[model samples]
Target chain A: MKDITEKPMQQWISKDNKAEKALKRVKQNTTARIGIGRSGARYKTDAFLRFWADQSAASDAVFTEVTPETIVNLGLFEIKTKCRSKFEMITRPDWGRIIEKDQQQILKEKCVKDPDVQIYFGDGLSSPSISANAEDMLQVLKLGLEHEGLSVGTPFFVRYCRVNTARTIGPLLNAKVVCVLIGERPGMQTDESMSAYIAYKPHPQMLESEYTVVSNISRHGIAPVEAAAHIVELILKISKAKKSGISL
Target chain B: MNNSEQAFISAGIDIGTTTTQVIFSKIRIKDTSGFGFIPKISITDKKIIYRSRIHLTPLTHENEIDALAVKELILNEYAKAGIAPSDIESGAVIITGESAEKRNAKAVTAAISEIAGNFVVAAAGGKLESVLAGKGSGAMTLSKKTGKRVANLDIGGGTTNICLFNNGKVEEAICVDIGGRLIRIDSDKISYSSAKIKECIKNLGLNIKEGQNIYNNNIVSDLETIASSMTSYLTYCIDPEMSLPKEWKDSPNTRLSNRPDIITISGGVADCIEKITSDSFAYGDIGILLGRKIKESTLTNTSFYQKSDETVNATVIGAGNFSFEISGSTIDYRNSTFPLKNVQIIDIEIDNTASTIKRKIEQFCSEYQNSTFALAAEGIKCPTFKQIEETAKLISSVFNFPEYQNKPVIIIIKEDMAKAFGQALRRKLDNNRQVICIDGIDCGIGDYIDIAKPVASGQAVPVVVKTLIF
Candidate 1:
């Protein structure tokens, strides 16, 4: 028993050297959390709404905070947003797919019976950076859409939703097109960000080729409003071409 | 090597969920006839001179008949060892898997009982049968060798059995419902289903139905799915909530560890040796294969035993060995046993006297549809006739109530379904009162009587109940 204890003790004391090496590696490749709440609840809802409102208002487009029920009547368009952490984003994909059952029932009652288009904005894993860059991007998007005379759908804010949820719910409500704005996974050096993913004929099992995406839409990266304008121009091109991804 | 030289052969049989195995040994009989008829004489010169030929019966769908085949195989092996059935000294049987729990398990035991009638039936008699059923020879051998408590976890293709031994004696054993074949795999990531699993087993050309609800003959994929699921369960089993033994927790190599002493894997999955090393080199199959060889020889000596070709014969061998051990009386193998007797059943009935009075109130609400008095009520702000009628149609469609499609109808119920319908209506109508289910008891007065005043007065919230009324 004494021999057994001594051998393990020697191994433990030597493990400090290994720990020091691990610490050095961690410092060289830093990963940070940007917009997540300390508590597990949806504490970042107000911040998300405020950011969405400012961005939409700056672009001359009215933004309304609607439940899953209200969104069905708003027709379809694209959504945009971001998140701050990788673990928070990956573990909760199902939470962002659809509204709760009770909310879904309410939407069936008050919203339009079924609309042609439905788009959503999700914060994915980098909400903080996406929110910061949204204002400038929306202005650019509005101008591009107007220049092409494309009739965009009503826009609104969706909290804690994912990009895929737009594809899933869009077809259920008979939406012809659905787009989502979500934040990309953040690396060590960069934090401020957002991205837009668009799809046509969206449904539960739509192919990846049915959509398009634009990443790094942020102040320190791609200018937010400018990226939004580029996205709108691409949307017009897709609508004229009647296709997306490899097909276009 | 002289004419007077005789041999005492001892054998062990293990009948597993997916396979059967047997093992045998022949020892020189000193100062006694090799036949088991005479009493044993203490002799230090006696020693095992030669081992009998190890044999196995192929598994088959006609497993009922396969037991006879196993007995014949055992007989042949005994002959090869230069001994007759009556001449063999001792043996043991360990039954396991679905066969042990079959409705005709007793009948099968009775049929095999005659073959080893001379020897004590260790597995068939008294309370020891169930206890010794799944205790493969591994645990038995370990117990005898270590003189300490040891447990054997027999992992088969479709099920896993855990048998424990203490102080060179059998204790308790249990079979967990999960197996290697049940684990699920979606590409590289392995996971388990929290939902019920339905699987089907096809033996030879005949499909044998097993599991919750048998659908198609796709046992291989189902087994893989189950095995993957066990990986997750193995993880959960180590949790403190599960109350696993402290030894299991303190060990650094739990489940996926490479420590050979901590755990051992045995069965069909163990054949994938590379996979075991990477995951946790904790599996072995030698004990079962050795058991199978002994059973085959026991059956060959008995004239009544027959053979089959569909399955890896292990159970029959186990059964044969078990019969020999009890009859030979070389060891007291009857400690663990369970008795079956005195079972009972019962039934119940209910009366329906209160339902007759509730029908009269429903009739009164129907008459108020076209009346001026009904329209004059406060909060009777019915939508334009078309909107009210359309709302009614939508409600009917949503609730699958096709009969009320073209009528200006109001539904009234006296049960819980009515309340659920009301809640559904409230949700669908956005708190509108186009549909409602009123609650009250009839006091045999006015046709439409309000037994209790409304709890809270508000606009009628449309509620849709989608339940079948009895």
Candidate 2:
């Protein structure tokens, strides 16, 4: 890690930005990344470097791995999709969705059947997100659901998991509401952001609109713990309505 | 598309030095997040459903507020609006200016709120009045919209509340004892003069006093001079570089660090800014004359002058509409009992070690011994789970105090980490006590926070923070 200046973007004003003080205050409440000064017609060196670095980091996140130790640390058993490796997972999207017969047996034997809610983690696009947020998010979501007296199924890890894997997992485990916390495709703003895909009574024939999604869960965004609490509340809503996503 | 929205009946009552006013508003809250996203609740709409006529604040004695009479007045407003006391869900009853100094000021405010309805806040102070008037008058919006510095002078009977806004944010709210009705007149004579006005008369060698004939040459001319000086003091407050009169030197609360691009006027005197008649003593007070002075002063002539959207009902309207805010949706709380009023806050730097943070919390609890306060902190941009666990341990340690065991432990932070921090805190408490951890509220020491019952399908709580400083 480099010791770099992480000044609140609002305070990074150029010497002659004229609106320096106003820009600083505007930056505090301002959501957009504006006021980046320029040299001639091009971005200033700092702005160019930052933009370049963030984009590179986003692309690089796709190739990373969620370490085995992290899975052990979180007390989650690991399972894999039909896709053999990261290369195959990215190239064959359909293969990444369906769990194999062997994995289905593992899920049936290891995971509780007919649970009110089933929550699991997957390293979909940005493995760093799972490594960064999985522990805290799981801790809050698990405790919050159990506190509400809802029976939650065994939590586990899915390698090369696509979001639609919930369609297969939900039917196999008899989970009324299936939730998968997966890494979102990295953006310039954050590579450590995750999304939670939840579905009620998911099946192989289910439509994409049947799943509810909460995206941008990270330290710089909604925060994993906050997102987890929100997920718990949303799960309750889905349970009461007997539906999720657009239908509910 | 499926949409859900909840509307609340709000009431705002202001008892000031000269007049009392009440306003009712319908505030609607809705979850703005799209179907798949997490809930983001906000006050979607606020409309003034009813605006009560300005009534002379009932005073039992010159030095005492008539609490019973005030209660009757609010009840009368409720009847006139065809609303019941039980209908009001949010809003505030604020006592402002010289009226707040009355012997029974606190009792009068309390009595008035009791009749208005539950959750109608009873607060009295000039600074709070200053902020409210600015927001209500639309001066704050003007600055925010134009991205320029704006200041509002709510020139009431006994005080002028000056609120400075920079890019819509309050820079500072300064209240001064310069207003229209500091000296009252009736039947061609000076019927009353406040202590501050008497000092001004003596300082300027005007020779004005109670019972002085208003028709006399010196009395009428001297009063005009006093009004002229009062308007200049307001300008001096805005731009300290101006020639400040000798009279205000003792009251150093006049100087401002930043100059405003525009000055908007509110309160009763705002209605009389343009001349209509020659009679100055028509209201049996110096209000009309002072308004005339403000209209004639350089304050009106400069580019820095703008008329506010409201005139007489600024404070009440502010108390009604702009007082309440919705907490962030992703907060953490369980076993909740809400509508908690007057919860104070203690702000500490987040970078400080947990032990150091605990010291600040202990000091605040000791200082504000009678009240339960929230531990408010600026949060780390992104904290590791280990960091959250460590901090939660320090936060839960505050429960060691015997009194805090049963009461809800509240923690408010500026970051969006309340859910994680709150979960960790619950683990530390073993779910034995109620814990309220909400984020996205920025507050500091001495601020009184009011938390409403959860709304938007229990995803968030409606909140109002009052700086009730006299």
Candidate 3:
């Protein structure tokens, strides 16, 4: 077979020049408006510290950074963050969901053997919304569950995570339920909001019926605290009903 | 029409990573004794009454499995045929490549079963790839004339499976978990940043800004780059082990026979065959060739089978054919036991809101005049373990329903949260009722609930439910 250069190849090679010009225009326009916040420039540095402070002050649940060395228990909570971009969310669901395989191993090493529930926060397509709303929601959820005399789990943060990853980790930690608070794909009206998706016996092959969802559960739509109250109620109902999402 | 007048209708459902296919067929029966009896009279022609196709995005998020996509596809296909959903007879669902790998494969299957209001069988685990390879080869043979045994390779969106056949019998098969869409392209090495990729797309004049605007917008240009990178990786990975005759080395791109005999490419990535072959030495026809062979083998085999005469809708056609096969049969042995004197199969449909479980029980009792000896309700979703207990309570109360007073109810609830819900139900039942939990993939409750004799069944036992604590 002769190695003929097809039309798709031509398009690929020519994309570089086109991308450069377009990128320059976008940078100029965005810089003029959003001004690239300090957190944007130093995402892993100062942002981490601020996130830690907020997380620590918001809840008494043991908090840990999702690093390679961090250990995860069955009922532990984890979250992922990413920039407010849909392309990244659509193209990179795996990145937003599961922890890096090696990092998952580290979690196994440092965390408890098994837990009752595992909660994760992911930036589905809106990092800012997840970071802002997730903390308050978590705090309220903890208070409600604890008040109901249900044991609370450890909580952590994930960078660029998706909803399924929480389910994947839930089974690994022996958790009966896994909740993920993530930024929903932003619409024109709002870019700073998040949602919570809770699943029972989450694994790679869970069905929508096995999950319970509380969408628009953020400060901008449903207040984080209020959302937390609903989540607590839903969780209780789910435990009693033994179902979630569409099945309910 | 006489009482003996009958019609054969079948449906094939293919759940791929990027899209789902549904096909329908109607065959006339001159006389009807029964399905297996092969009517005493014969008809000369079988016509395709309806055909429909749709492209869909894979369920990547946990919350995305609302069954709306499947529902829309099924309903639209029925509408296209100008028939109601209940009018459809039998159907088969083939979960190939990515859909089979989803975390909620069982739940998705159960949901579809409830909506379809019929028995739905999912080809999963090792069976998916094997059946796919077998069926794919059968599809290819419809288009080509080949005497030699060949291999069929299906390059889908997330994975690739290769099957070798000799004289229409599957000899060996292998599935590789790498696909075209999933090929990671590191832009940093290509002189472009993530920001640049988005900019280039915007420059294409799509007006797509940040966030949710990304979906439904064409990113064909960006996809081209990703395709190029993917081709490079695939070529590097499969080249070494690819068993190709040396004769085809000079014109390897066109020598489909020596390379794979017949490659039938299905799934979302197959749509980008042109891109995959460009800037690389591989050929796109390799996939098609494989598809042809698979199709041919299945048709030629000596077994109960139905083959498609058209191109590009094999999965749907297959599903439709299977649906007809089931409808024509006497009883659904897969979903219910035989000798229907003592047993009954009760299917329940629940909504996606609160109090659905309670409502399902109400609906069940209002519909059935007598207490069912065995109850199996499909499609229940509860978020927490607490909900599972409530659902079990509702199932237990079914015995108290006026029609079911004092009747022992062996209740089977099919929900996505089978493991969690099962645990919660077991705790609530705790010696009060006989509660058994069967994993959807492991055992079909309809097949086991009314077993005449008690034998050890390989079912997942109910374990105590636990939560994740940090």
Candidate 4:
């Protein structure tokens, strides 16, 4: 990768000063590609190169895998989905949402029964987001819930996971509320953005609106430590309302 | 729109030396944090809903402010606007120019503030009034729109308030005892004269006194001298350290870094002067003549004199607008600990050591002599859960000392970790003491912040940040 320049790169070589100044002001607030000077109705060399660089980074994030050392550092035991490879998980999304018959017995033996809140961490699309924010976010959230005197179940990690996996895992653990924190799809703006999907009671027949989601958890968006406090408060509201998602 | 997005009613009352006016406005607050994120609440829109008819400031026998009459006037205006006092959420009452010197000015301001309902602010200062007048006159917005430096001269009844705006922020402000109502003309004789006007007359060697008729020979020259005095001050022709006129010596000098590209005149005399022709004293004063004199005098440094959106009601409109700030949603607070007024924010270095934090707290306590203040730390260094916990422990150690015991601890952080850090501190400290922690407000060291109680439907609070230094 090549480093970009610190000074502003002006796009208008023909010299409309007012338009150039306006573009500069807009560029200060956003990272989207804009105002790149064109050469004969085509993007300039620098702009083309930068676009390719962002695309390559987004591609890399999708194929990456969470490391074993990271799971051990966060003190979480890992579980596998029915999908064996990244290719299978990407093409067959339904396979990633279910656990095998043998894995269900293991889940029940290791997890607490009838817990007030159960939390899960998974690498959905970008492995960097899980490795970057999950440990700190989990630590702060666990502390906050304990302060509120709520019973939190044993935390675990899942491999090749999809969002719908909560529907199968919730019933097996007998949890009243289940929250899944996973990486979001990578975009040119950021690759480490994360999302938290929470459901009151997970079942196969639950509608899409039955899940309440909080997304864009990153350093530039919502700081992971700050997001933890909001997550705990949201769980309390879900419990008191006896509902989640659009119903709450 | 979400349930937290609601509109609030605000009212602004300006009690000036020559006139009193009222304005009501509506402010819209909405959550913009988007889906699946912490709610970042902000005020997105403001509109003026009502503009009251301008009224004369009623005075008592001793020329003091009549508090009862003023209260009745406000009540009538609210009734005319079809609003109850309880409907007002936040606003300000500003006493400007000569009215600020009245013996009962404080009492009148307090009376209006109580009558205006909760969250209404009471303020009396020349510099703050100058800045507000500039904001209301559209000088601030003009600077932002045109990207040019703007200077506003608010020539009201008793004083000429000047404020310079660059990039939509107030750069400099100064007030001088030069205005349209300084000399009141009744029929063909001078009915009333201020002491400052007497000094100007003596400086020009004019044979004039109270009750004397101004002949045609000296009237134009006298008015020209008054107008030129104001122009010379704005153009920097008058030396502030040595040759500043005695009338302006009491007010601090204006400090401008660059010459303004546009000059705007607001307040009561602005409309009359921009037309440049008036025969009669319609307001029973020298306002018309003063306006004509000011029009004739030229400001050599400025390129253009732009028209403002407001004229006489500039201060009241500014007071109604631009008077509140909404806090971020994730603040740590209890319902009983709010509506804090005039709390000073003493900024400190973001040190992780507990001893350094203790020293700064002790130094602030000794300097302020046990006055209640909020500890405003800049963005935390390395904002992780462990780092935030360590900072919280450091704060608890400083506030739990013998000298600072039992005081409600107020902490303001610049980052979004207020809830995390606040909860950690609460768990570490004794349960007897109260804690109020807020975030997402980045204020300078000398600034003062006032926090109002949270709104009924939203958890976000309203904050007012002010810098009163000249």
* Most DockQ-accurate candidate: 4
Candidate 2 lDDT tens digits, B244-269: 78876666565568888888999889
Q: In order, what lDDT does every prediction score?
A: 0.37, 0.84, 0.45, 0.78
Task: Please give the distance, in angstroms, between residue A8's alpha carbon in candidate 1 and its true position after superposition.
Answer: 38
Q: What ranking of all candidate models by lDDT puts the best one first?
A: 2, 4, 3, 1
Tens-digit lDDT string for candidate 1 (B1-470): 01143444545454444445555544333323232111122222323333333333234452442666656655555556565545434454444554455454455445443453223132422123223332333445455444444443444434444444554454554454434334333322223221123321221122323332222455434443333334334333322243333222332222211111112223443333223243221222122222222233321223322221112222233233322211110111011111111101000011111122122222433654432110001111211222223333344443333422322223333211222223333334322233333321111121121111111111111111111111
Docking class of 4: medium
lDDT of 3 by residue, B339-456 (tens): 1222344444422232454455456557765645445556343233334445645654544456444444444444333333333343343334444333221122233222221111
Superposition error at B379 for model 1 (Å): 88
Report the Cα RMSD per candidate: 33.0, 3.4, 27.8, 3.7
TM-score of each: 0.28, 0.90, 0.32, 0.89
C-alpha-based local distance difference test score of model 4 = 0.78
- In candidate 1, position A189 carries an lDDT of 33
Better of 2 and 4 by TM-score: 2
Misplaced by over 4 Å in model 2 are: A1-55, A63-77, A85-87, A102-117, A147-154, A174-176, A237-242, B252-254, B346-372, B400-403, B430-432, B468-470
For A165-212, candidate 3 gives per-residue lDDT tens digits of: 765577667776678776666543345567778877677877756666
Among all candidates shown, the one with the greatest TM-score: 2
Cα lDDT of model 4 by residue, A1-248, tens digit:
44653232333222333576666655655666677767899987877876777677677778888889999999998898999977788898999898898878778888888888999998888888988789778988888887777788999988889999999998888888999998889987667888999999889889889888888888757888878878888888888887888787
Instruction: Tell me which residue pairs clash in candidate 2.
Output: none
Error of 4 at B121 (Å): 1.0
Give the per-residue Cα lDDT of candidate 2 at B225: 88
